[model samples]
Target: MRRCPGGRSWRRAAWRLRCFRFVKIDCYSIETNIQIFAVCASVARRCGYPNRPDRGGGPMNFSARGLSAMFSVLRQRNFAIYTSGSTVSLIGTWMQRVTVGWLCWELTGSGAWLGLLAFADMFPSVIVGPLAGAAADRWDRLRIARISQMLGLLQATFLFVALVAGFLTIELLFAVVLFHGVVEAFNQPSRLALIHSLVGRERLGAAVAINSIAFNLARFVGPAIAGVLIATVGVAWAFALNAMTFGAFALALAAVSLVRDDALAPRSGFLREIVDGFAYSVRHPGIGPILMLMIAAGVGGRAVVELLPGFAADVFGAGPIGLAALTSSVAVGAILGGFVVGVRQSYTGLTRTVIVSVFGIALAVAAFTVTDTLYLGAAALAVAGFFMVTTGVGSQTLVQLAVDGSMRGRVLSLHGLIFRGGPALGALLMGVSSEFAGLRLPVAVGAAILAICAFFALTRVNAIADALENEPRN
Candidate 1:
């Protein structure tokens, strides 16, 4: 007779008693019979049920159909709020940019000051970006973003009031621009950091691409609208509308539900955190190269945006409409570039894509410099925009994918600095060059530099492609 374990033996006895009622059994064999019944019951139970594995292991259950369904559920309302708000706000912002550039041209009639003003407005990001990045990592990003928007609103209102009171001077405008630049320095880092929270990690790339799409779309529309508005309603209305647009974004931000995660590292002393962030970024091979590429692009290529007014006034001989068209053309190309990225499912070989884009942008800028016709110049600008967006978005995706959750905010802040600050430096250089060599020369020089950089980047494409190919699986 087989002896059953203590708990199983009792259950076996009960089963045997039930069986005995239907068929006769010897007393000596009762224990053996009971043990057999218990073994059979246990085997049946084991075969009928199995334990589930933990979440991390095993094949993921998501199919293409399931993933599509999931994305459809999560993206609808949140995307609308983010995309629409940014669209409205960015249009107003671009309009103000065009109007301000035109106003600067009107005041000094010097291309150098135009560059200086653009530099003043963007340079602060470089100076303050490290600190801002640290703050973004430590602080509540949504709150910081909201605060920055409010400050921008205040600046726009101040500009509008000053313009209306007949107290507006070039110096005052420059001062206002500097103040706005400071706010933007802080705002941009926070905004970039906050994006991850709006959508989860799986959807981050798509979200970034979509955001770029919205921004470029606004870029396409805003300058054109601003051109018409500035010509018809005056610059004051542009400022007024800009102020109102900021308010709308603020409202939209207030309406969104942000889930805060407390897993990030605690805030440290400002200088200490900045040092840590810098060290971490420099040590990261992937992030380091991407950052360098961004800086090069910013300094070498992005200065063209600042030169639009000069191009319109001196080269094209068309007024606000020409300026608007030039700006919009770039934006149109960018929008198309972003759309292409958004539609693509894989990010494989993105480095090659970026290198191609840089080369294409340089070639377009060079062509624009030589082209005298407004239509031809606009077409060149459009092509430049397409390449610019492709390069910008591709680099952005690479950086975001390389960093860890803890380093996202600080690293992204550095990204914003390079992105915004590089352009400021370029504008300064171009502005100085324009003063001595004429508008076309500075653009031509920038285009040549971009071409050189693109060539160098392409040379390293295989190494970059290999690195991306071996990126850590999320």
Candidate 2:
């Protein structure tokens, strides 16, 4: 028999890949030829032949400068490292989320079940968020984060094992997801509060935008991968991959050294502190109104994201691939929005933008619900996603800029609660209503509610800008 060009099969393949040569082609089978081509393509990529050497002209230079401006927050070493690890972890999180949603659909095929799953994954925040925020304020934020990540790893591992062993019933999944929601409730505030410490007040907007960019980037990639895994191998492996990502993030959290000291001593009981957080967020002029706007958007607009499987499987009849494409399209638009927010040095016109995005998302989602075409629906969802990111990042940065240092953790926890919980509440309501009225009609009504909220919010835009954009006196 004629062997490959080198000694052993793997060695010969490696040698051929390294040398970029194919000799005596008749000696190789078609399978071997395909393998060799794949290896050569990988080698080509590693050798940096993406663009022609002469292509580094003015347009290329301009593009590079723009990207540099967009990612300027990465100049801070700690923020860069943290962002990298979090991006990896968030990708796995999204993968697991998509897998679970698909698995639920496979098992029950009920929109109500899917909505319940999302609720279990998010509603624990309503119960635990305030206390967790208090803990974040009183304890070491990094330590809390590291522990939460380790717990996340544990949860992902358990999920993998259970799914593989065929023991993961819907009830069990609900319990496990609810536990994860509680862990996230604790983790969110600590992690968010760390942003100020990592990059300081000056770069806070860019850092928040960069963080959102990382999240949506993961959102873009993870579901596509999960869909492929589910179509080919299964859901168990997706959970396995997610577990590894959690471990990676834990290691990253361990590696970072903080530039700012955010350590605080406990001055009161946990309940007292929790109550104070609620009152403070309620009373703050800019923070209060902005958060109310987020609540409305989260319930009316963001819940549609959690209900996407129904849209893909039932509405579009395009199945898992359609689901991935739809989710990725949203992420693409959010990434674009993040870039828009990231490059801005000032908060000028941002509050108004936030209000506009509320209206924008309402219109986009309404358009999306009315569309029967999958491609048109994806386009509409992308517009909604752009507005979603704009609203989320703008409101978050404003809150961060306007809040007192001591109250950061609690205030941010309230933000997290609304971010997660509002959707949970809306999903459950819309999901149940969909069973009676159909998915499209319920979603349209929710969008109308969002638009109404945005109209009222428009009147307070100037006051919000004055309170949020100006430096806090305290």
Candidate 3:
């Protein structure tokens, strides 16, 4: 076999993979072949699979190696268990979300009610996130996550019961959604901080990326499952299914053990700690700036995603199919982007990647605004989604790696608050603006805002990298 530029090691792996698969290697582009080879080799080393010289060893399994690398963080036994349960729970969560939205529309037949429902689901983070963060730091993170998930299961069960018993109303539905929103507000920070204990600092980035991949995967799968259930059995079954998943996750949480727990010393007042988390994040050179960048993209660039339905109806004239196409495109891009970032072994160039992704998202959205064709618009939105996940996951991974252990929950809560709430605020503003100025221009202006923020971030990349990457662990 002729040697490739990547050297003999990867080539040998590729040759072995090619022989095992029994397909023509030339069917895939050389570049694609190289990537497959690289991922196979890297996963082999990481997962303790054999990739030594072409001795009389057995044939290599490229697919197994690729999957191992994609889920490399699962090597942490606790995380693997946690992830197994959470994956089931997340799919159910999405099912419930879709069912609830459909039920709301059926009852009210008002777009205004749908907007209000979305606001209720998202706005609690603004009020509850800081306090929740403080609680995560003060109490046991695993305990908090388990309790919140249990509450989620109960919420789903109640919704199902109410719907079956003929006592459900719009007011009750609204109230229940708001209650669950508060539960999730508490859940987000604790669950995120808990990953550190389960996986340790070395695998934190991979864990975060894997979490995102699972989320996007469920985003696609859940709606399809919900649609089938809602159409055939009943809308109530979606909630029932969600309740089961939540129970599974809660049980899984009970089964896992933490590898490294952050000792929560008795701190000052709870309110003081919340304030201190904010103060520390604001004062830190690296976190402070990247956070500001995230907010800009969240409000401006990310907000556009929430308005895609309007774009489909008004700009593309494709209706539900157009909306589904655009939505699926985004999900595909996000999953692919998460997979790409998940394989990294270091944070060496991640800061720059984060900054560049901000620009990529902005430009992609800007391109989307100008396109009148549905296919082109979907393509552009896919690019936006790719950059959107990269920016989110990248910023989050950096924050997780840089934050002091004591402040992990509090700082991450701030990150979670902006991640969940910023786009809601932006969507409200941009949605209203679209009513007066039209949809395209408001989205275009939001992209412009994001581009400007990226330009500012470009100037500070080196400083942010040094502060985030070089900081000593607590």
Candidate 4:
């Protein structure tokens, strides 16, 4: 009952949560009442829980109002159905993903392997994503997504049953990861393309933004859940839960119908289209450098994400929960980054944001690397993750602002590849480096390199913004 203005949100939440832990033993006692009261007041006073104080000094429930405001595009029936379903599905996907990292670390205890697992999981998107984007023009986007998710479900089942059977191996893990990566390679493009079918051009931005928000939200929530489940139920059930959630996404996809325009489809051959896409990405001054910057940041800053499981087990000496906190810190930072961008809503400033965020990531990574304690490491990671998202979203926004309408598909596909594949390669290199030099050295080096590249890229700020100013759109 003491006022503590200096108490940070995390500290407040931590204490209130500890108090709540004793509530089950004395559900109706004064202590329990106090615990509940503490959590509610802290959440309202400190955490942004969509509640506001009334004129009469009482809090009003504004959670629904907040949700509606953030996701106004969900007013469309199909968009709502897909976003809701996909959000659930993505949470499970993240859980399985976190479990995979934990399981890999448990089996191998190698930072190299942690990086390898990340490479196995995400590298496919880099390799096959552009082809998939071209293919999505020919195939039904919804159908492709449904099929890809089914394949993902199958991959999850294998991991679940294998882990449960006590026959899982490192080789088997890589194989499953590679196959699932292939599935995601196709799924990413189809899903992105599917948005056009669900929402008109007028609201496409909101739909796209909401979809992205859901994915990042899962990035935070899923790892937290995985940590709990891995601590309690083991990793097998994590896979099983992930497999089950795919059904929700499948059903949602099946329920929606969209009319495809054959005329809008690609007329060029796949090979030439691929060549043309490559040309467009490089020929432009703005798109080319942004893509290049993405690659640098992806490898140097973003790929540090894959190293988190190693941090949890080796550095933090905690299990799934620690890993969750580590990974979720990044996601939390990323979510905050999204809010920062949304709130600022300035186009001219975004180019600088891209550079600033890249610098921020480097600083966070440096802090994380040198820290002697887990709390400091997690805090640093959260800060780094925030920069990661800002750099990512900022670069993408710049690309869109500067891209040609005729080259939209190829440019965006390249964006996907640069961000996804670059990180995969970065993880592979960093993972190997971590094995030799240890986690701190390789990570610190990468962050330092990224800082240099980000600063160097600042030389092109005017060109990038000017390109955006004169961009041609379809």
Model 3 scores a C-alpha lDDT of 0.76
Q: Write the per-residue lDDT of candidate 1 for residues 279-330, one digit (tens) a residue.
A: 8888876677667877877877888888889988998886666677677777
- Per lDDT, the best of the predicted structures is 2
Task: Evaluate model 1: give its TM-score.
Answer: 0.83
Query: For model 4, how does the per-residue alpha-carbon lDDT over 1-474 read when each residue is reduced to its tens digit?
Result: 112224589977765564454333223222332333333334224322222222111122235564455467677788888888899899989998888888898889998888888898888877788887677655667788889878888989999999888899999999999898878876776676566567654444445556666777899778867765665457888899899888888888888776432224556887777677778789887788778888888888888888888877777775556677667766766666554443332354556666766777777888888975765666677677666766776676566556554455556777777767877888899889887887888888888999999888887777775665356454
Q: What does candidate 2's lDDT look like per residue over 1-474, in tens digits?
A: 112355569986675563342222112222332343343334223322122222110011125676686578798888888998999999999998888888888888888988998998887888888888898889888899899999999999999999878798988988888888889887888988888889888778779999999999999889878866765567888999999999999999889988985557368899899999899889988899999999999999999999999999999986777787778778867876676667554566677778877887898899989987776787777777777987899889889888888888899999999999999988888888888988999899999999999999988777877888775632
Model 2, residue 184: what's the lDDT?
A: 89
TM-score of 2: 0.86
Worst 10 residues of 4 by lDDT: 49-58
Q: Which of the two, 3 or 4, has more TM-score?
A: 4
Write down the RMSD of all candidates, one decimal each: 27.0, 10.6, 13.3, 9.8
Model 3: residues with Cα > 4 Å off, grouped in runs: 1-70, 104-112, 164-171, 231-234, 309-324, 371-373
Q: After superposition, how far is residue 316 of candidate 2 from its true place, in Å?
A: 0.5
lDDT, each prediction: 0.74, 0.81, 0.76, 0.70
Best by TM-score: 2
